[model samples]
Structures are given as structure tokens and as C-alpha cells.
Target: MTSRESALIDALRMIATHPAARGLADDAAVLPVEAGGLVLTHDMLVEGVHFLPDDPADSVAWKLVAVNMSDLAAKGAMPLGVLTGHGLGRDRDWDSLFVEGLADALRIFNVPLLGGDTVAMPAGAPVTLGLTAIGRAPECGAPSRSGAKAGDDLWVSGPLGDAGAGLAIRQGRMDGGLASLVTAYQRPQPNLPLGQALASLVSAMADVSDGLLIDARRIAEASGCGVAVQMDAVPLSDALMMVRPDSWETRIEATTAGDDYVLLFTAAPDRRQAIEAASSRHGGNARRIGCCTADRGFALSWRGGAVPLPARLGFEHG
Candidate 1:
């Protein structure tokens, strides 16, 4: 290994205190799964795509970790540890800051840094980072996207559109002032406790990483059912509404803009009270915004009237 690579591993060794990490000397991490099933998730972030070039290195690191953790949260799993693949580029200082941020994120999530590999990037290549989060599935079992049944009520764990607005602000498409919205885009908090609590209650669940509309459509397609979204009932943060006028257009924009890390789930109509209680107990603002229908595709309604589906639903890699 190069001196820089060796130094980076030395820095990582400080945070990889988990017994499975083997002091970062081994090629792979050794994790012991005694009883329950393990939930594995991998997520990646790229410069200029997932984040802006001017975005703070620390926040980028945090996003890299949180996105993977969000996947675990969707599975209603408790995080075990994380393995990261960091592409080394020209910015050494930025890399150091990222290490610091990774340390913070690992601590905040109470997850340890396992073993991972690092590679030098080609000149002028964008910085790409990947993280694999390992979590223990809930005893009730990890909820799947295809588990939703006909007549189930659709729910969201928190407000939407804040991160999209933040991105707009960052891109100069919108005026700035809402620090909260900017922060939302920079750092997303995965609601693990809420996910865990709702594990047994939810019929289907997924985190809203792409856009709410697209992700919900995924659930519908997976479950072989139709998802009817009540556009007017879609939850928007007061901060988002304050920045952009609340309107049908705005709501549509918010739902399709993507980057909201909230959980979108479905449960039986009879389980509404139980779902609400579970969410409330975990400090989540779960809102019912739609329902699963017997039909075969996605539909949207606003103010009790049919609304045309947007041309774009959410972000897609290809």
C-alpha cells in the first residue's frame, strides 16, 4: 500500500473498534450471527450526482453512511456494523474530513466500522463512496415491499420535499434562507426506532430514497396491487410550505423531487390505531396519505378528484 493509503487505514483503525473488524488488519470482517437473520444493504454516493461539489465533506460522509442505514431501517433491523469502500481522489484534506464524519456517523448510529477496501481514483474522476450496512432483522421478520395487501392504508413516517427543496436551493434554482431544508439535504436521519416499532405492524415498508411516487409504485408492482395516493393528504413540512407556496403543482413537485429519507409503509385499515400508537411512541409523525387498491397500477387523486400522473415519478440511475 502507498503511504497515503496506509495512513488512511491507520485513521480508520481508530474507529473500527468492533470485535469483528480485526483491527483493520484482515482482508475481511468476521461477524458472528448467532440466531436471527441478517439484513444487508449497500448504497453509494458520487460527487456531482448524489451531492454538490461544494457540499461539506463531512456531510457527504454522513450521507454515505445514513443512506445505507436507511435501508436497514426500512427492513426494521438493528444495525450491526458497516463496511465502506472509499475512492481516494486528489483532495487529501477532504478525505480526512470524511473520515472524521464517518467516525461521527458510526458513533451516532451505534454501529462499528468493519473491514473495507480503498482504491486510488483516476485523475479528474469524481469521488465515489460505497457503504454496506449489516443489521439484524426483527424477530417478527423484515417487512418486504411485496407484503402490502389490497385495502391496506399507506403511511409516511415524516414530512417530504424538504431535501428536494434543499437541493434546489443549493443549485440556485430557488432562493435560500431555510437552513433546516439545506441541512435536510445534507444529512438525513434514518428513523431506526420507529422502523423497529412498526416492524410487526406494517404489511409493507420502504424508505423514500428515490421519490415517494416511484417508491410507492414499486410497492404496488411488487405486491401485485394498485396504490392510490391522495395528493392533498401528502405530508409537507411547514418549512417546505413556507418556502414554496402550497399548491397542487408544489405537492407534485415535492413528491417527485426525491431525496426524502422518510419511511413509506402500508398497514391494514384496522391497524391504523396500532400503527399510529407505535409511531407516536417512537417520536415519529406517521401520516396516512393513501391506500392500496385492487386495481393494477398507480393512481393519484387531489381533493377527491382524479389527478393525472406526472411524467416523472422520481430519480433513477439509468
Candidate 2:
């Protein structure tokens, strides 16, 4: 399951299989259009849940856009535009800053603002923002979480755990001296180009929105296979290492920590060269972390021994 929230989605899925929903197996809804299919996704961010009150409004806006874009990237779709839903707050200056951040994200990602609605909420209500992202898929079917096969090599686009480190900084648990960690948590870079390149090449793909363990399990469950993640192969950014020491425990936390929007995909061993070339072309430091197995769940291993699964896979809501 992609989320523990799947119980509600499962109930909705019982009645919501519109063919265009793709059985609700993939991240975005695909609607067959004239030239190709249109990929559509909507995501919401609450004030305290997704961002802190003291965090920059612009960064919050940027994160809202980036997170949605990350979903599109998973489907190997090129973003067309976005429609925003904004909850107006009492602080007009904060709202203005959010607009600036939103504008910056739009310009940076080359996605346009198609338009949306805004509402004035109660005085102290938390600000909630949502975005509906629309994209166009290629002639080939959009890559899906259910596409991974046994014997497929699993790969991740870049480093993990940096955002978790950044989150700690924002919470004042650590000094904000490490700019990379702070920036990673606040503004994430989705591998759009790599996604485009691997559209037809990879067997399955997803952006690591939740922790890597949970997200990888999503593909495994959707594909009806098992996934074995090599703990040592999980890459950690130098920035993260600078703040946290090098150890297996640190690696596990990095693997399970959320907010790193890196692309995780599976490809046949034969496609290694092409995958490497694509990553190089896109400025991504791709790593082969593990492989899909014929079994039914996740297995973690390092230094010739298996590691116990963590009690918690990732962030889960009550």
C-alpha cells in the first residue's frame, strides 16, 4: 500500500473504478485524450502538518508545488499546468510571500497557473493549500507502481535522508548552519528529466514521498512481489553525513525518513547502461540499491546479514 490512509481509499476504490482511475493503482489518474492520455493528480498541505508556522510561506508554497510535481514525475508525465486552492489567512504579508514562492516554483518548473479558487477562513484557522496538477503522458503507457517484476533491479535517483536532517534544523533540534540539509527539507528537487527519459525504459517508478521503505513496499505490493533493499547501497548525501555520523543506524533512519523526493524505479539488468546514461544526462547520481524478488514482502540486508524491519515504516496518520 502507498499509504496507511489506503483504508479510506480502498473503500472509495470499491466504488470509484472509472477505467480512467487505472484501478487507482497508480499515483495519477490517466484519462485517454486525443493525442495521448492526460495525467491528473491533486494534493493538499495543511499548515502544521506539512509545514511549520515559522517556516517561510514561499517555501511552503514551493513544497506544495514540488510534491505534486513529484507525483507527475513518477508517472513519467510532463506537467502542463496547475490549479491552486488557497485558504486565506489573517496575515496578508504571509499570503503575499506565499504568492512569491508559488510564482518562483511555477517559473522554475515551467508549469503554468491555469487558475483556481481562494477562501477566507476563520481568524486562527490553519492555512490549507491544495494544487491540482495536470500532465500529458507519452504514447507508451505511463510507468506504474504495479509494473515492477521479479528479477528487476531497483534504483534510486539520488541521496536520501537530507530532508530529515533539514527538518531537524527547522525544529531547532540542531543548528541551522548546514545549508544543504535546510534547503533540502524546505525545497526539494524532483527528477523530472530522469522520469521523462525512463518512461519506457523502467518497469516501475515512484518518487519517494513517504519513507523509502514504505514507498518501495508500495511498488512491491502493487506488483505482487517482494523487494530486497541493500542497506549499504542506500546513498547518503555528504551534507547529511556532515551533520549525522556514519553508521548503519543512520543509514536506516535515512532510508525510512520522509521528504526526500528522489525517484525510485526498476529496470532489467540489460537496461543498466541506458539507466546510467539517463542519470548522467540529467545530473542525477543514480544508485542500484536492490532488486525485486518473487516473495511477498520487504527484506533489508547489509554486510552479509539481514536487518530487522523497523517498528514503524514511515509517517502515518491516525
Off by over 4 Å in 1: none
Tens digit per residue, CA lDDT, model 2, 247-284: 88788788887999999999899999999999999999
**For residues 1-318, what per-residue lDDT tens digits would candidate 1 score against the true structure?**
557777788889999999999999998999988697899999999998899989999999999999998999999999999999988865768878989999999999999999899888898999888999999999999999999998999999999999999999999999964899999999999899999999999999999999999999999999999999999889999899888888998998889888889999999999999989988998899999999999987899998899899999999768
What ranges in model 2 sit over 4 Å off? 1-34
| Alpha-carbon RMSD of each model | 1.1, 9.5
Q: What TM-score do all the candidates reach, one by one?
A: 0.98, 0.88
Top-lDDT candidate index: 1
Displacement of residue 123 (Cα, Å) in model 2 is 1.6
